[model samples]
Target: MPLPRPLAPTGRVAVVAPASAPLDPADAHAGLSVLRERGLRVETADPAGGPAAYLAGTDDARVAALNAALARDDLDALVCVRGGYGVLRILDRVDYAAARAHPKLVVGYSDVTALHLALWKEAGLPGVSGPMVASDWGVGLDAETEADFWRVVGGDAGYDVRGPGGEALTPLAPGEAEGVLLGGNLALVTALLGTPFLPDLTGAILFVEDVGEAPYRIDGMLARLRLAGVLGRLGGLVFGMFTGADVAPGRPTFSVDEVLAHYAPSVGGPVASGLVYGHVPRKSTLPVGVRARLTCGAEARLHVLDPVAA
Candidate 1:
């Protein structure tokens, strides 16, 4: 995996709305301040307030804003303003030649996942899944979340990330394994299953998270991965927060935990839940296409085995 150069404390970064517009101007501004507080030079690529039909802007507009950012020579990285439902539409519009020509970290989660996958396929560079200006940063990040996010993006040395439940992981499937860290939001991951954008997860620690999905839908996506033979080649599975996935009484369905319990064991490698990376307030960041290790036991922790950036 090719890691981009690690962003320095005062590195230049651009914020762009590649998916949905920031719902609130203040939230977006506040989120940008978070990056500034991290000692970064943050700039907005385009007006995040630009409106469209459920998009931050028209497909061309969004693509152009992103391309402009990617083409810049002074930027050290790019962070998204928000993620909703437009990145896939502009995924192919990315200036791959420019992106590959000047590799740097691109950060976001949720619908921005499509962009990350597209970058991997098109630019052959990995991305960081962390706080977005309108979401995680605007809401507020706990110390653990903020530290992990910066450490993954700014530092050169890899570190260990223990789940919330110390001593032992919340749910552990015995064994230890290492592989390239990959995957993000469950919905986006499933959406790209049959697409050229999806990377080959031959032996990757596939971490997944999602929100507002029912238990059955979550199970369905996981089932799709399994049926697609995607899970069979995994070195491990890191189950992150699946918020709003509680089953309602109306439908007869297996619980999210049940679904994971059923599949994690079958992966035949370390499996654990409660990773602090998802659509949660206090969440950590993951570097896609980088080496990671998972040790399942009383002292289980996901260790970033390699630098995500130079």
Candidate 2:
């Protein structure tokens, strides 16, 4: 897939909620302010008003909002307001044709992973697996996170993704591999399995992360990936922050690290952990479907080999 046009300094960005509504309206407003401060023209969709339980709105409303943004040639990018749930429910109804035609940057993570994977597979469109309005910008980004986000989106030259203090990721298995960067929230990626939306990850540098899932659950998901031959087809594998993976008191279970260790040997190439991308405040904004290289050893590094944006 070709890279989408980079966000111009004065680019027009449309903010829409395609998943769950914001937990706090104030946070959403604050996030929008951050975008304005960057000198970008920010447009927002009306709240898809409806009592649809956990969803931002009814399936039809969310789909309409997302599709409208995808079809707008005036927009340089579509920024998701937040990601909780609902994307999976409407993946089939998405406007893939408009996405292929417009090919604007679609930015968000978590539940937004479903949209990213679907857009990539169905329309050959690349996207930023980065922060969302209510999720990151609303609370304020750490210096590293803010810098990395703009650097990738602004069409800056290729660079290495490092920890907050320039530390290397922990090496799991020793080796080197290069492939397009793909994968996101573990649960979302796993859910897309057996679906047409899951991209062909053969030789792709797959990275995954999750929050609030137990070690056993993580083990099950990784097992499924291995059983489905997903792990064996990867050029490399990266484990990001698996936050909130602690087991309950008195529960007998393996540690998250142990679970990962059990599956590392099944990967086709190098493996690494501690990638600073996940549900945390500080993260490296990664571009999905972009070529990248990963080296797993004492001097481990993940390098973006292709420009994320044109």
- Per-candidate RMSD, Å: 2.2, 1.3
Q: Indicate the residue-level lDDT of 249 in model 1.
A: 71
Among all windows of ten consecutive residues in candidate 1, which has the lowest summed lDDT?
162-171
TM-score of 2: 0.96
* Global lDDT scores for all candidate models: 0.82, 0.89
- Candidate 2 lDDT over 147-264, as tens digits, reads 8888888776567888665757888888899998998999999999999999999999999999999999999999999999999998999999999988779999999999998899
Best by lDDT: 2
lDDT tens string, model 1, 76-153? 899999998888887777898888888889989999888887788777888998889888787777777776777888
Off by over 4 Å in 2: none
| Residue 61 C-alpha lDDT in model 2 | 89
Regions of candidate 1 where Cα sits further than 4 Å from its true position: 47-49, 163-168, 297-299
Question: Model 2 clash pairs?
Answer: none
